[model samples]
Target: MPQDRIKTIGRSRIQYGPLSDRVYLMQLAAGEAEAVITAMAELAQAEGYTKLFAKIPGKNAAVFEDAGFEIEAQIPDFYADGDKALFVSRFICKNRRRSCDAERIQKVLEAALKRAGAGIRHPLPSDWDLTFMTADRAEQMAALYSRVFDSYPFPIFDADYIRHSMDENFRYFGILQNATLIALASAERIESGVEMTDFATAPKHRRASLAAHLLAAMEADARQNGVKTAFTIARAVSYGINIMFARAGYTFGGTLVNNTNISGRVQSMNIWYKPLAPCPSNG
Candidate 1:
């Protein structure tokens, strides 16, 4: 399946295509809510998309609610000014509103919640080298992502796309052994914080607690960079990722039902977030 295309409509960024079979209002600009809503609806109708997913400020929820959207999840203080980010959705296809894997999803959530605050930060293994990835390493990163995920919401398997994202606000990090990249993750800069995402570990390296170490390092780096918060939208049915976040002390915000197309299917996602200490002032 082709990757979704991200485009700008009325100052807001949207990702819509056959890959996810939905229109994702990824970012919304102030006061552009109505135009974005209308445009996304029109696009969804013309393309026969089954879902319209949006992440908007809580204050603007009323407008979207009036347009048939309902809040699926939310992260408080998601913005720098203390505004919450609401994950709202309107399912054009009735079946899309319900997850077929609801039982498994809930089980994962319960397991993760039981392990909350149990994550202990471990040092990077003696033989592993943890390094911040540059654009030159985009190919290696893309190769790792390709091996791990059959499909992703973003075009992470493309080397050029990885490079482009690095040039933007994304900072990729990798754990390597003997010069071979074994695990990878990235932190995307958002206003006053970063999104800790794109975590992938080589199959052979699983159960070694690599993700926990990476999460710790990412949090430290984000704090040093003046980031005030860190968050992730992980695959809801995945035990490892959800538990990892819970162990790392991230609070469970809620779930976005069938909101993301990942690993070759439309899957729901769980929101997790943590507040980070700000960088020290130079003065």
Candidate 2:
């Protein structure tokens, strides 16, 4: 299957394609909100997409709202300039606005919150080691993501993309057993915060609490690097990931309706966030 395409429009970055049947305004550059808004609408119309999702600074949300966009989630003080981050959406196909799995999504959220902080700091298995990934491991990382998800919003199945991202504010973490990568995650730097995403574990490696372990390490790394916050847009129906984030002290923001395409289908996502204290610089 063909993956989504990412491109820049008037200094703004976007991802749009049939894989997700939506256009995502991934980054809205300064003074480019109007251009992005127009472009996203045209692209969605041209491609027959069902949704137009955007992550914009709170100050510019009124522009999008004036264009028929609605707020789905918000992150307070997400940017270095003290502006909140808003996840806004405009629905092209009205039917795509509702989720049939609302009950399950809620159940998962409740369960995760109910088990918050239970064994989240479990020790890594004796034979496994957690380490930061180098470029040489890009192929292995891509392969791991391919095995875990049939389709994803990002081109994680491509080694070159992984390498390029690693060079641009992306820190990947992996767990290895006997020197072979088995589980993986990444932290993407965005201004003063980092988005903890791209989590995947081999089928055989499930139920071992590896995601929580990776989150803890990612948080430590972020603090040491002066990052102030961490957040994730996790699949709402996924009990494991939601539980893991809640267990690690992340607050539940709000859910995005039919926002992402992952594992071969469109799914709503839940936002989770946590504040991190910046550690004294060792250097």
Candidate 3:
């Protein structure tokens, strides 16, 4: 198995790994502009990666392009606010020529994503026994996710993502009632603050405020870890989640137009951010 690399450039956070011939980049923060450029240049030099790819907010498209990345795809109305997203990539070495027309490919992919209506929600319950997942816990979490998101691709609830969470110093919590897994949430540090990911609750547990309880617990954990802000990318269609985050004092940061690819379709995502008492300096 190959190990993924994570680096903090200034306040920005980046994660990258080799997926075959291409280097797949995930979780690039907006604040780490110079750091990402320097780090990418170094990675290109050392790893001989042919291409580097990332998903970024539409507003930040020009920054990546200026850094040598080209738009390979764009998804419209893919976020909760119906904003657009650009999928970008660049050849590490100038000598490596790309074969496909990036603009054209992006148009095709965006059309397909528009047809798929997968959406997300957030700021869920914080109650129950929430902790890192064990093998048994993974199975239970998968089953709950499958039931909650029957139309979307279920996450590969293996120990690897869980271990990755641990490596990043993230707290992965699962809610259990009567020893049965009912909900889950994850919090990881980012350049801006802390981001909550992979929040889900089983259908049977919905409307019972399980998600709200879980979110409260997650927030408490984040505060303990020196995280002063909380954020999430939620589905625009998920009214319940949006409301929950609002009730918790999280303000609307912005939306990533088409940031999520689900069930072979594109959907819009909303960016919700909350200041956890004292905000962390982006210094």
Candidate 4:
């Protein structure tokens, strides 16, 4: 049986899952460290969870390790601001054995990474107008996204998605030409840094550097907001977008293969990172 728990710790909500003889934890914060750890151990014991697995920030990793969790994987700069993310797992009782599919997962991830390498471009454009997308501009932005990614996995032109993006983050930008949306980028802020989500340019406006302009705008917004770096997971098939990012000075950081299933195939994704300023610190 699988059960979930939502515990309020300070201003953050920590969500955890207990399944079979295993527990999975997520949405942890620094302030609630002690409580969360205690709750996890208690839950593991009560629910007969012999093992626990979680992804946590590097800063709070010591707490988990001290609690007997072993660092199973280290994803560098997995979160914003270049904070490394640690995957930790612990065995509760001596007699219990936990089975894992780590190797299969890793192989899928590696395939995705290989795909990312074939289609990316770093160091994007420098000069472009970037602005927040309002209700008035939502339709135009959607149209442009549709034109660029006609077969995107998610409905890019949805009004609800646009509103959610605006409400959740200040990292959304639109490239306008004569007051018409030609390109767009959306991002969300995380504890370690900013994650670039959707970036697209109208097909009719490609080659004219509309996507480049949009990225430049995103960079400006990142700087203004004290963001240290910007990162993204790009589809391995999008050659044009990758090329523009490369031209603008972004670097290939890492990749997550088959992390996302898109267009009926398990698409590979490339991770890219751009430092906002020289010698920037994520913390």
The TM-score between candidate 2 and the true structure equals 0.96
- In order of appearance, the predictions have TM-scores of 0.97, 0.96, 0.56, 0.57
lDDT digits (tens) for residues 1-283 of candidate 1: 8889999997889999988899999899999999999999999999999999998989999999999999988888878789998889999999999999899999999999999999764666798998899988889999999999989999999999999998899988899999999999999997776899999999999888888888888999999988888999999999999999999999998888888899889899999999897767899
lDDT by residue for model 4 (1-283), tens? 2234445656445444432344556467667766777777787778676666565788888888888887655556656656776657676765443223335434544444455423223333445445777766777777776665534434566766677667765456886666767778887776646767677766676677666666666677777777776777676556655556565666665443333334343344555666677334579
RMSD of each: 1.3, 1.4, 9.9, 8.2
**Please, what are the lDDT tens digits per residue for candidate 3 over residues 1-283?**
2434555656555555442334445555657655676777677668766666665667778788888888755544333344555567676655444322345434433443343323223434444565656544556665665566533322334455555556655666777766888778777675436667777887777776666666777787777666656777666556566666666656554443333433233344556666566435579
User: Per-model C-alpha lDDT, please?
Assistant: 0.92, 0.92, 0.58, 0.61
Candidate 2: Cα lDDT at 139: 96
**What TM-score does prediction 1 earn?**
0.97
Off by over 4 Å in 2: 118-121, 280-283
Give Cα distance to truth, residue 269, candidate 1, Å. Answer: 0.5
Give the per-residue lDDT digits (tens) of candidate 2, residues 1-283.
Answer: 5888999998889999998889999889999898889999998888899999998899998899999999999889889988989999999999999899999998999999997767575678888999999999999999999999988998999999999999999999999998889899999998788999999999997888898888899999999898988999999999999999998888888999998889889999999998897786679
Rank candidates, TM-score, best first. Answer: 1, 2, 4, 3
Worst 10 residues of 1 by lDDT: 119-128
